[model samples]
Target: MLALGIEGSANKIGVGIVRLDGSILANPRHTYITPPGQGFLPRETAIHHQQHILPIVQAALKEAGVTPDQIDCLCYTRGPGMGAPLQAGAVVVRILSLLWKKPIVAVNHCVAHIEMGRVVTGAVDPVVLYVSGGNTQVIAYSEGKYRIFGETIDIAVGNCLDRFARVLKISNDPSPGYNIEQIAKKGNKFIELPYVVKGMDVSFSGILSFIEAVAVQQLETNEFTDADLCFSLQETVFAMLVEITERAMAHCDKKDVLVVGGVGCNIRLQDMMRIMCSERGGNLYATDDRYCVDNGAMIAYTGLLAFANGVTTPLEEATFTQRFRTDDVHAVWREKKSLPLKENGVVNPGIN
Candidate 1:
């Protein structure tokens, strides 16, 4: 079966086509490179989506050597993203589904991240650590659903990083997150910062404030380098995430851990998580920018599974949700035992 997926969640506009057998026929990706001077203004983002999304979608379909009529299923990110951008994707997918007489599946953005990690890692029951610009959480598969074990009480990890970058006048030209990652590598000294972890939940607003205060103080003294501060900030935040993820694995008795979402692409964060998981006799799985960052391929891959299991959204049910959760989705695999976990937290090869 051929499926088309569209993702216009935040700043990126990704379109892709995939077959039922988990093969990507064509994946055309694009993002609005917001100028560093303007930052991420929602109105400007919406305007950019309107101007660029369609062409990218058309290009993907053309590259896949498939006409719109050949698609059997239509899928798109349903929410947990900017409303304007989400609506832009939903309207296009909805119209295309109607015109082609194909079934439409509204996939949760976070669940897509989880599914993509599973696809990339081949992990049956890994503890999921999803970190992105708009979200940060620890999740696990339980009782036929992906459940949220713990999450951020306030702002997301990547959002905190972006805000911190802005305060330091760091460039957002290529990508705000990429710029911060580069600056952080040059940092040499570790600065003491607030490390707050209330049980499994985390808070970054306080940390951001503390960093901003330090930045201001350093400007007055003219004694601090932005690189050092960036490094310290990344170290503090990533340490918190690793702590929580390790805690969740211990609590859930899971030995395999999967890291998803945009922030999962950060080399430093992934390296830290990998080391922690290894120390506990656990395996860590992470995605590269292709699947780790926001994209339509994940949505389409997830939607194909959902459709095969008789899951489809009615045309009248078309609507965008701003706060969809990964745990809200029901498992769509063919067999329950396919995701069996051994007592030692390893997948049972005999089960599937």
Candidate 2:
């Protein structure tokens, strides 16, 4: 079966086509970039999606070398994202569903990330660390859903990084987080920042505020460079994440760790996680920017999994939500023995 998915939960708008065999036929995306030191608002972001969603969908189909008649299902991100942006994608998806006469699947955004990470990295039954602009969560599968073992008490780690980049007036051309990662490589000095980790949850508001203040005051004095601040921020926040993730792994008795979401692309964060996983005598699973950041392929792939398991969203229920939790969906497709095959370090998710 073939599926096409749309993603517009935030600043990005993407369309992707995937086969039931876990092959990503085509994935095309566009981002609405704002000026340096500015963040994307929901209205403007939604407008961006409205303007580009059609062309992007066409591009995805063209790249995949397929027609709508060949697609078996339509998929889209239903929630856990900005309201306006989510609605924008949802509307287009509904129209396409009608036009193509295909069934619709509404996928949770966070679950899509986890599913994509699992297929791409071939990490079976691993503790997942999901960190992005709007979410920070430590999740494990239990019962019939992805259980949230821990999460952010305040803002997400990526949000903190983005806001910090705004404070330093860094470029958001590609992404603020990516820019921060690049500059952080030049940092040698580590400035102290607030580390707030309460039990399994983390709080980044205090850290962001403290760092923003420090940047405003100390940056002018040349006492600390932007790179140093970026490095320090990365180190502190990542350490907190590592601590929580390790604790969750020990509690759950899991040996593998999978990192997903936009913030998971940070090299420093991955290095930190790798170190922790090594210390625990386990392995770390992570994807590059393609799967790490939000995209349409993940949605399509996860939705296909649900569709194959006799799941479909009725037209009346084909709507968007802003605050859907990860654990709310019943993951009917997962079997206890479902595992991807890996050959020569390449994962074959279709083998399941």
Candidate 3:
């Protein structure tokens, strides 16, 4: 079966067409570059989504050489995203589903990230570390469900990065995170920062405030370079994530790791994660831009899996949920008692 997926979770509008076998026929993204001082104001972000949603979807359909009638299912992000953007995408999906008489599936945005990583890496049972604009958590499949082993107790990782970038007057031109990464690369010194990890939950708010104070002090005394501060900040935060992930792997007895979500695209973080995984005699997996960042392909791929398991939401039942959790969804993979021995690697059942 063929499915068309629409995603407008935050500042990006993505559209994709995918086959049931997990091949992406077409994938396209429209990014909204927020102006300086905008700072995620809901009204401004909503306006951005209104302007680009339809065009991106149309472009994806044209590129895929398919029409609404040709698509067997229509899928869209149900929630765990910005409210206005979710509404915009849902309105379009509702209309398309009605017009084409196709079944519509509502998918959780976080689970889509997890499934996308699995699809790209073909990892049987990997410990998942999801870090994005709105979330950060460690997950694993167990007892017929994806369980959350640990997560952030306060602000998200991406949000913290963006806020710090704004404070530094870094350009949000291409991407705020990218600009932060560039500034961080030029950093040469290590500045002490707050590290808050309560039990299995992490917090970044205090760290953000501390960084701002340091920046203020440097400005007053003309004492430090922004690059050094940026480098120190990234190192401290990324190390926290690596520490938690390592702990989760040991607790869960997982030998494989998959990193997903927008922040997963960060090269520095990926490098740190790879080192941690290697030390544990395991491997780390990451999705390319196609799946790492928010996109329609992951949403469609996840929706297809949900649909196959007899899951469907009615038009009236459709509603946006901004705080959906990964553990809320049922696991599609089932652990088998007997492991199959192969020349390549250990294989698990229920995943193609």
- For lDDT, the strongest prediction is 2
Q: Give the TM-score of candidate 3.
A: 0.93
Residue-wise lDDT of candidate 1 within 1-352, one digit each (tens)?
A: 7788888888888887877666777777777775553467667777788788889888988788789888889999998899888888888888887778898999999988887677656777899999999999999988878899889999999999888888877777667777889988988878899999989999999999999999999999867788989999999999999999988999999888899988888999988988898899878887678778898888887887788778899987867888888778887663433222121234322200
Evaluated with TM-score, which candidate comes out highest?
2
State the TM-score for model 1: 0.93
Model 3, span 1-352: residue lDDT tens? 7788888889888988877667787779888887753466656777888888888888988988888889878899987888888888888888887888898888889988888777667776898999998899988888878899999988999889989888888877767777788889988889999998776678999999999999989999877899988898899999999988888999999877899998888889988999888888998888556678899988887787777667777987766777777778775534322123121132312111
Instruction: Candidate 1: give the clashing pairs.
Output: none
Model 1 clashes, total count:
0
- Please estimate how well model 3 matches the true structure, expressed as its whole-model Cα lDDT: 0.81
The list of candidate 1 runs beyond 4 A from truth reads: 334-352
Task: Give per-residue lDDT, candidate 3, residue 287.
Answer: 56
**Alpha-carbon TM-score of each model against the true structure:** 0.93, 0.96, 0.93
Model 2 Cα lDDT, one tens digit per residue, 53-75: 99999999899889999999999
The number of residue pairs in model 2 that clash at the backbone is 0
Write down the TM-score for model 2. Answer: 0.96
Q: Would you give me the overall lDDT of model 2?
A: 0.90
Worst 10 residues of 2 by lDDT: 343-352
Give the poorly placed runs of model 2, Cα more than 4 Å off: 336-352
